[model samples]
Target chain A: MSDFQFDKIALIGIGLIGSSIARAIKLHGLAREISISTRSPLTLARAEELELGTFYTESAAECVKDADLVIVSVPVGASGAVAEQIAPALKQGAILTDVGSTKASVISQMQPFVPEGVHFIPGHPVAGTEHSGPDAGFADLFEGRWCILTPVEDTDAEAVRKLRSFWESLGSRVDEMDAEHHDKVLAIVSHLPHIIAYNIVGTAEDLETVTESEVIKYSASGFRDFTRLAASDPVMWRDVCLHNKDAILEMLARFSEDLAYLQRAIRWGEGDKLFDLFTRTRAVRRSIIEAGQDIAEADFGRHIRHEK
Target chain B: MSDFQFDKIALIGIGLIGSSIARAIKLHGLAREISISTRSPLTLARAEELELGTFYTESAAECVKDADLVIVSVPVGASGAVAEQIAPALKQGAILTDVGSTKASVISQMQPFVPEGVHFIPGHPVAGTEHSGPDAGFADLFEGRWCILTPVEDTDAEAVRKLRSFWESLGSRVDEMDAEHHDKVLAIVSHLPHIIAYNIVGTAEDLETVTESEVIKYSASGFRDFTRLAASDPVMWRDVCLHNKDAILEMLARFSEDLAYLQRAIRWGEGDKLFDLFTRTRAVRRSIIEAGQDIAEADFGRHIRHEK
Candidate 1:
């Protein structure tokens, strides 16, 4: 706690990501004072009850006043509105960042409102469980997870360094990239997977041949895996799909194309092709486990943490 | 143990499913003698090491001699060959059943080889983890799970009743359904999910734009959930796809149609549509949790049991 960096950090939209960052900051004593704001009075009162911050307000502008760092953790679609609300009260020379999943949209939504003195850096911590809301947060949610910071060109190097240090103090590994590249990378890795999960689960629900109860009953065989992801925050995912449309659609197209080919192989009794694909995909799981991105400690750690 | 039924039980494939049944049967004293056979000498030796049965034989025919009950647990594609190999040695009036995922194909493949006196019933235990091999077997694997029995016309009722008792002893709820219906139900529930998982994981691997390491590093977002199912037994899943082609194709066709609709919604920025679909799917997960099919008890139980 001796190296506590920021005098104050303002968290706008204290939901899952905001609350998680609050937990991490408090656990590491990264900030002397934490101010929180949300659009809903109910959520604001809830945050106060949880004591997630030194001060709670419904005004984003009030929350950002005199803060050394301002983190906007709203849905991507609300980025512009949050920026507009906070721009008036942002401290000169303060680091203003966001933890939205889609970076390009966040930059576009936020960069225009940035005053000359404030560093407008867009970031996304590539970490979270399917659960949402303040109670879903935990101190170590970002531990060993990648926090991608997408700083636009000509952004202050000092501001980037401070932001990196802030994330590092919260147990995240920070890396920098352009906003567009980050969106494209995330489109395939995160957005597409969620979309696919939602789609498949939707498909199963719409099935007339097989009842939904049967799908639920035998889901442990395979379909249940998708249910966990499909149960993600709907509003957040909706915003992500709309904001990262181009990159997500591109990935979705490729995914659909590959799926069609696999479907044909199954229809044509091409056992060899199916075997090859199934065998090849097994290696990716091994790689994920080896990378320490997955909980190599056990097979079901991901789900267990979600339950907790 | 006085209620034990079978005089002699022969297991023709001592892998995960077979070995599990062997342990359950032995623990419950379900049979006077248990004979295990495997084509692979290594597996036979390992099964012997596990003390899975009272006697072990390299020949399926030699193992089934004088057996009143025969349970074949093999890859669906190998069902015909195994049936032909052991058909002559099957004792008169024996109840011959299988634990194949695909019932229609197994019944089609094995029925002709089964002698007139044998009660050839096709059964599927709707339970198993992704893990495979004899070493992965556990006695309680079948607890509180469903097992569907698809009996052919003129199949002996007494034999069906006896098989139900056997599965009940192993702690599975047994149900009767026709072979085609079983295939369709399983296609939507199990097969299609595995196919989609394998396909999406394969698509991720083939992307040059997003490195495999990046996908794995950030997989916790949702992609890692798919990887577990994708890492399942390739040979077993391949046999399933090959054996149950029509039903899987039907499910795949429905799946693609629904995906295209969702893709269009995403392309057209239909947030309400996406939100509605996402919300509807969450109920299925709730139903699953309510049904006790996936309540995270297994992992915690395993943790406690292993600690002890």
Candidate 2:
């Protein structure tokens, strides 16, 4: 049997995730034809130059014409705009999905415009790097990563299965959950971590007592790790903060409360309290490694020091 | 001229930093012999199994006997205890230094115990990995890293010069700073980041809305980055928090205050404010890369997503 799943796969917003999807589709021969589109003419041209897809267009509507699968891979903030532009062009019975970070917001924004016959399955592939753009993507970006799907109750079961298989072919472990739960879980795991990293880097930058040079010079001590996350695409993260406002706010509130307790312990020189919390947190990392969510390599296997 | 700077070097702790120093000393032929000691008999045995030094002992005093250079590499909290144990045995005119993260407190703890002729200098190598123990040590742990020395005003200048040369031979760029300044600088750069990472990981683990499995499954989004730092040795970090309480508390106050401001910005839906802060922090990462404090590789150059 042929491995081809979709006759035509249209990818809107050819950034990191979108380009990676295109590459994976090509690598796996999952789609017979791939069409790519983005709002920016330069990005579209770049995508074309990179030969990421079989067809390239500046119009989302033109890109999605006759497509069996339309994947909206844009920032969460741009979801509604892309949806409206492509909704009329979406083929009947086509599966429409997204690879946004915020599932609930993206669902809300796109569900209104999605045609009645189209299967609108909102998803978030919990995989990325700080770098974005077509050049930063690789075919294996989603491999060994989890891709979550939050389909509405009335969505066709067969459509959901097909979509799950599509992601599986791309080497993602697919799981289904309600949109609300996905948002809440992601708010804690993804959104809040990025916000905290961005906030801490900003805090270090604005310090009057510590110069930027000093902060950068000594960053490898610990601060450099935060900077890696803080250096992520600002627009995508900004959209994540704006779209997933309530869930992120809730997580932030909890994080701050915990931080306040830690601060009080530090102030009082409560060594036992500090040590207990520190010891408890270490187990989380071990669990992540055991679950295969992270590599067991030392220092992320950076080869930081030269061999003697 | 022969590069052998010391006839005998004693390492008063056999953990990561201490063993790394032993390896570096041997790699560079900087010392004729190395005596390794730790409070724990098991750790001493492990150090001996690794053949980290020419001699190994459980007695800190015995380790320091007849040593021309003595490096106390215990946690900051244990500095005073180790100092008192080895003080009477320290050779006259020997250079006594430490690799504690904190400076002012370490100096205060060890300075009074120093003999009349021993040159007491407190130093910190702004380098480490999340892993601990003697096996985690490598010869190049200090390569291309900074080692800050905070010598007392009345300390011998020749002793300081020899110590500088010693670290230079270990491949570290050495800088001199006052103990107070070193404490403050490290407070913002090192201590606060670790504390914040620990606090955030703990908060995530305690969340009622998100399951631990969900957090681990979706960690690649951003949470995994913090876990790397949070996975660090708990005892060392607890000691850091306790020894640098004043500086760490001050930095924590600043960090919490700044985080509060960010919290307000997100709660108020201030996208522009969020974008500006995110954009500004990106520059710091670039500066760190340019300063060679961090690798310019993407995604921390993790071979993550491979080996499936």
Contacts from the true interface found in each model, as a fraction, amount to 0.72, 0.83
Clash totals, every prediction: 0, 0
Candidate 1 per-residue lDDT, tens place, A1-308, comes to: 44669999999988888999998899888889999999899988988888899999989999999999999998899999989888988999999999999998888888899998999988999888766788777777787788999999898999999999999888778888888888888988888888888888988888887777778777767787787778788899999999999999899899989988988888888889999999999899889877876644333532233231
TM-score for each model: 0.95, 0.98
DockQ of each: 0.54, 0.73
Clash total of candidate 1: 0
Q: Could you give candidate 2's per-residue lDDT for residues B14-99 as a string of tens digits?
A: 88899999999988899888999998999999998998999988899999999999999988989999999999999999999999
Query: What is candidate 2's local distance difference test score?
Result: 0.89
Clashing pairs in 1: none
Q: List the residue pairs that clash in candidate 2.
A: none
Model 1, B128-195: lDDT tens per residue? Answer: 76667888777777777789999999888999999999999998888898999899999988899889
lDDT for B157 in candidate 2 is: 92
lDDT of 2 at A86: 95
Q: Root-mean-square deviation of each candidate, in angstroms?
A: 3.0, 1.5
Please report how far candidate 2 places residue A14 from its true position, in Å: 1.0
